[model samples]
Target: MSHASTAVQERPTPPGGPGAPESGLSSRSLPRLAPVGFAAVAIVLAVGLGLAAGWHSKVQWGMIAALFFLAISYAVTSVVENRRQAKDRLATSIVWVCFLIAVIPLVSLLWTTVSRGAERLDGYFLTHSMAGVLGSEASGGVYHALIGTLEQVGIATVISAPLGLLTAVYLVEYGKGSLAKAVTFFVDVMTGIPSIVAGLFILSIMLIFEIQPSGLMGALALTILMMPVVVRSTEEMLKLVPNELREASLALGIPKWRTILKVVLPTAIGGITTGVMLAIARIAGETAPIILLVFGSQLINANPFSGAQSSLPFYIYEQYKIGEAASYDRAWAAALVLIAFVMILNLVARGIARWKAPKTGR
Candidate 1:
């Protein structure tokens, strides 16, 4: 403490000489309401210019307002503060512009889907099947497709999740050298493999075997697409487990495999479960594989392994392609249902993760 005090006292004077004022804090700053004022002015200027030019596009006005807001913010900040502060404000403005640009299209899509789908979405629509409904009649529901989707996705999850978990454990815990490298290389490859490619690969196999279309075949294709995502996500979660935890477990006379099963897996289970759910969400909406393998059916097929089946994605596509008003309504309704299904899966995943999270002492 004495040495620190002495060193502080002995510190060299500034190049400006003794008693120079500190430069650590800003000498000037903008008012808190300056941004709001700038935005209001920007909006008015944009509207006035648009009106003078006889333009009717609100998008153009919004873009112009954004540009005016950014420019005015930078210019005013530079005058009130410094170039560096002005640059920071400009960067923040650019980020906001980019965020709005990304979000607008998503909001627009949701609004359109909900408005159109609400017309035909009801209990009768949800309970009946399209077995006897005509393209122009619009009196059927997606219950059959919903059943097929559930079965196919459930089968894929059953097949892929355990395999992915095992592969990730191997890579993290016991893997080394060329074999591990090859596995890692293939995993990265599979991560980017197109969904259609997986479908086509399964289709070729079916052609060779002369097998009929079934939901199990579609499930297999989905499994191929889902496994890599599970492996990548689980591997990342496992890597986050501290080596010290593993070492302490080993020091307590637990075998490595037992330690991994208990200490490591439980620690990472929440992330692992979430990743599996995300993979399920990704595969749940896939239409290509279902088209190539399941061969969409109008009547419900409870037996996935032997008969044709319909899935929600395929149902949406089939209805949309029919070129009738009723079909369009059904398509929109199916889209809304698909969206809700994915959203519910995500919510369930969050709940499971929270429930399984390790507790800590207060």
Candidate 2:
């Protein structure tokens, strides 16, 4: 053979699989189907072990399966690839397992709620007041509770949303030194305060003034619980707005307040709306404050400012406390309504956010 041919034969294209990875990258890795195959094996082994060991709980079965999957993934990857690859596979496995652990329970709870709640959820149960929903009879509905929740929540939103938005703006735009720090410290403290504390705070004022139980009282308690969340969430959203936008607006000789109103507020409107909705959701389910302030009336009190009223949370608690078969149905139905109300708020927030979001890529 010629000299050129000899050199070509000597080199022979350094042997390895096609398109092998370079340094600082993986050379060999697990196949895409490897996880699925490993999961199947793990399930089989776990089930066999569980049955043999006389385990009755499905939770134990799931735990054993997760353990087997992790072990199998690491061992197989280490043998097939390398220790580094095995470690990566192990971490990924751990994350998937943890995600399943969180999601499975949520799915189960939603399933239970939907199934149980549907039994008593209907137009009749919605439009009629529970004025006479007595024992062993399904004559009453959640109309009264719905009215109280709407009136109380609306009043609270009107009271708290603006205060939260302005406070967030001050903290981000002009707040400094001792005042800002003090405000932040108080907000943080309020964020951690229990719902009962807010109720008691309002209750003390009520007692001092001889004020009667009313939806207005519940709104006041909810306002305290809501403002801090609004402040924190709105502050984070405001901080996310690039300083360049503000600077550019201010360079045109616009006043700081005007620039904030025209530029900053619009930009962060979506997040602020979401934050407000979250705060509303938080207080919407609070039974303690309502119990203390509104006092849970069975009769529909449309005028929230004067008379006692009932809310979805309060209604659920009262029904569940009855412990009758019909009461249980009404309780589940009220729980479902509460969930749906929160979901609608979230949807509205998302819609508002999308519509008001700053346009880009013109």
Model 1, poorest ten-residue lDDT window? 17-26
In terms of lDDT, the poorest run of 10 residues in model 2 is 17-26
What's model 1's lDDT at 299?
96
Tens digits of lDDT, candidate 2, 56-95: 8989999999999999999998877867788888999999
Candidate 2 residue runs with Cα over 4 Å from true position: 1-28
Please list the C-alpha lDDT of all candidates, in the order they appear.
Answer: 0.94, 0.92
Judge candidate 1 at residue 100 and give its lDDT: 86
As a TM-score, model 2 comes out at 0.92
Model 1: CA > 4 A from native: 1-25
For candidate 2, the C-alpha RMSD (Å) to the true structure equals: 3.7
RMSD of each: 5.8, 3.7
